[model samples]
Target: MQFCDDCGSLMHADGDEMVCSSCGARVPKDRERAAQFVSTEKQTFDDVIESSEEAADEGLPSTEATCEECGHDRAWYTIKQTASADEPPTRFFKCQECGHRWRGYN
Candidate 1:
């Protein structure tokens, strides 16, 4: 397995190319070109640590939606990134008490 020269992360040989998931550095059949590409990546170990700290500071909140019919907690929060909204902000919710769903926008 060839490690990414950029991030030192493991690189998997994907068919005709080796790709580094952490740094997106692709190593072609030519080892020389891959070395150059890895050097181009500007990320460092310190950057990774700083990013983790920032994420920890921004706490994740639990889902508030509940099931109305079964009286169960149906709320869940997704820590996924999304594109910026072009329209007004909107929220969709389902009640745990009766499985009732509603949408609110502001």
Candidate 2:
């Protein structure tokens, strides 16, 4: 979780030091700080499934947009702020039948 002070890039825990991936900066890690950054937990499939469920479209609203790939007349959509704050948000559509994805700007 440490970042390079010079380049602001993520730093990897090397032997007795934190090495920046972007810049060649190195920072010495103390014994207490080094132990805090070490990870002993193992990742499981259940952890991935739980995290991916938040991005799923199961709870998203559906509309009557036509899918170009399958010609399906229904789709699930989500709106996101992709542009600057002064600009309008973007609408992303996913085809209900074929799982095709597209984006529309407002």
Candidate 3:
């Protein structure tokens, strides 16, 4: 990106020129200027989003977990990392009927 010499604000890449928004000055696009502002290829990364649907997917064992809010008799549970590596993982429960979520330490 280029900056306006007059107003010191960032300039945008307009068609064939770099136009300053604050000062309305136009800098002609050149090979050296384009090379200085070339965009690098974006690095691919894995998505870090964890969803409730993905967590409650089929194959998890169902135990009789009572919902504290709605009194539902069923829920899906999974162990999640909540502490340091030396400690035991915590159990998370989601109610089947009312979708109430709770956690148990043991």
Candidate 4:
């Protein structure tokens, strides 16, 4: 067990230095030392969490529209909403494989 130099509390190995959990004190820094021992080591972590809203905003596929004629996947699609009695909804699609053109209004 190591003792803190500042508060004389028990210190445990936290990371790079012995830290006192109760008093929240670590090893004192020596400004006189310009360079010290250096080592290249890999750090490991057990768990990580990320926000899902960031993924959705990055142009990830949140929703997909399937073509009813040939069942083709598309990166971009047009959205059509329901129309009132005086107006009618219109959607147009052109297929490259079968050279088919279809449209619906109503």
lDDT agreement with native, every candidate = 0.58, 0.84, 0.80, 0.50
Cα RMSD (angstroms) for every candidate in the order listed = 11.3, 5.1, 8.5, 16.0
TM-score per prediction, in order, is 0.27, 0.49, 0.44, 0.25
Residues 12-35 of candidate 1: C-alpha lDDT, one tens digit per residue:
656568889898899775666555
lDDT of 2 by residue, 22-92 (tens): 99799898687776775444444664543464357767899999999999999899999998999999999
Look at candidate 3 and tell me the lDDT of residue 50. 45
lDDT of 3 by residue, 1-106 (tens): 7788889898877779888999899988777769777643454445634455755444576789899999989888999889998999999888888778889997
Better of 1 and 3 by TM-score: 3
Model 3: residues >4 Å from true position, as ranges? 1-59
Q: CA lDDT of 55 in candidate 2?
A: 55
In the predicted model 2, the residue pairs found to clash are none
Poorest 10 consecutive residues by lDDT, candidate 2: 46-55
